[model samples]
Target: MRAHKITFAALAVIAGLSLTACQNDDDAAAKTDPSPVTTASPSSGDSGSDGSDPASPEASSGGKDTSAGTGSDKPGQAAKCRTDGLKITAIDNFIDGDPDGTVAVEMKNTSGRDCVIAGFAGVDLKTNAGTLSAERKGEPGDPYVLKSGKSIAFSVTYPLNETGGSGVRITGLVVTPPNETKSVTLPWPGKPSLPVTDGSGDPVRVGPIGSAGQGG
Candidate 1:
């Protein structure tokens, strides 16, 4: 009977030890294996809500500002038109060869006093390609002396070899009275003139009678 009691106590002690060891093991596992902490990802749309990135071009480039500098793409950026007292009264297109044509530019001294045009009046023909055909000197007359409010006319012609469109530019009227230079640019019909050079290092050739002067 005593031996049986001793065996029963020993089994009870062993069972208690096993329960305590299991409880200790459970506590150790709870401390070592904690719940994982979550992290944000770029694809998860988590950056916008936070104040990290301001989400602007300036912010992306280290807060450096970007703007159009001087002479930017804006209206009214072109140079304004400049005009002097000299005036061009008329530019007449006269007959040349058969079906082709020519142009004669008539300039008038519109100023009240007599103006001395020291240099030769020049005519530049601009082509469709924006290329200048040649510069011709106008038929220079005697030093034009005009009475106040009176006018005198000077003419220059450009000849066309073939039928098409060409642009005409008239310049080089150096008015000595006001000491100013004036020019006029217009589009007219004509073919390119034959290129030539002159003694003054300017081009000079007899074009269709009207298109005469220093060639470009």
Candidate 2:
């Protein structure tokens, strides 16, 4: 009877040990593989307060689409329009003649719109001493139409002798478009001066005169 009681107790201990081992294996498996769960609640207002739809692609990307034109689609902006459509390119040459010297003014139309040059174009010669003398060339007539990307050349003959200088001094050259009082200055290679036969019978090199002045 004593031996049988001992065997019964051993069997009970083995059963308990087996049950505990199975429970431990289940707990480890659950920890290793976790499943994702979805909730009904929305994340934020941008996600849609009513929860009907997702945010637009732009909104989701965090900004508005700017590929399309938004503001200021005019050909030339207001500020650009204020200035004449013409831009001075190169002052080709200055020729010494009866007057001080004639300056060749070259210009380019840089604006998007076509430039119509109809009225008077003026070029001012300034001595190193800051004395300003202006020469007017071309009167109002048929507009000198310059399409976009086109160039035009005009001459402004000034009395270089009047300036009383061996070298022609050109402080500034400006062109005034029709109906517009403002003038745009033509860019020159260097300080305005050209050598040539002085107006006097005696040949005096007036310096480098503009090619336009020489009728080039």
Candidate 3:
């Protein structure tokens, strides 16, 4: 009976060891191969914002939308308006706010290529003895793109008694465009429309150069 009891205890110990080993095997398998997780993929056709490719007009040209008609010329590529390409002409006009004797002027772009003009045109009322400088008037505004055959306007205003009591007559005016060194002579009206300067060093009151046919 003692030998049988010892054999039964040994059998019980062996069965417990086998059961523990099976549990450890299962834990190891669970760690090595886990259940796969599902994830959504991105759309293969999506390029970027605005639903357009990288080579689109707004993207390729450095963020410029060419369809909006901004301009073809790039910044710093084209030169300023040249004296040779400009044709200055004089027109008589009387504006309420301006002085009594106002001479309207036009700067036509005769150049074959597009150019830029802005601010005021330097004016020197040409006299027989010497040239009298014109006092610039008005605030400087944005530059205008003067394309081929397009033009802009500016004016030179004079005092009511332009003769300065000397009865002097102005033959014409020597106009130098903004950023230009050379000056062009624009013939005055048949009579003395521009007043003779009193050597006050005050400008002849030149206006800003804006769109063509529009008095500036």
C-alpha lDDT of residue 129 in model 1: 31
What value of lDDT does candidate 2 attain over all alpha carbons?
0.41
Kindly list the per-residue Cα lDDT of model 1 for residues 1-216, writing each as its tens digit: 111122566657667577678567667776776667779775653332211222223211122111211111134221111125345433344454534333443333444433233224444544333334334344423222222233333334333333233323323222111123455655443333422323333332212211222111
Give the better candidate number (1 or 2) by lDDT: 2
- Per-model lDDT: 0.34, 0.41, 0.60
Q: Over the full model, what C-alpha lDDT does candidate 3 score relative to the true structure?
A: 0.60
Model 2's TM-score against the true structure: 0.39
Model 1 ranges off by over 4 Å: 1-83, 96-100, 137-139, 163-180, 187-216
lDDT of 2 by residue, 1-216 (tens): 111122566657667567678567667766766655668986554322221121122211122222211112244311112235656554535543344344455555578654333334444444454534343433333223344554555555443343345654445544554345687665544435533334443221221112132111
RMSD of each: 24.7, 21.3, 14.6
The alpha-carbon lDDT assigned to residue 16 of candidate 3 equals 59
Least well predicted 10-residue stretch by lDDT in candidate 3: 58-67
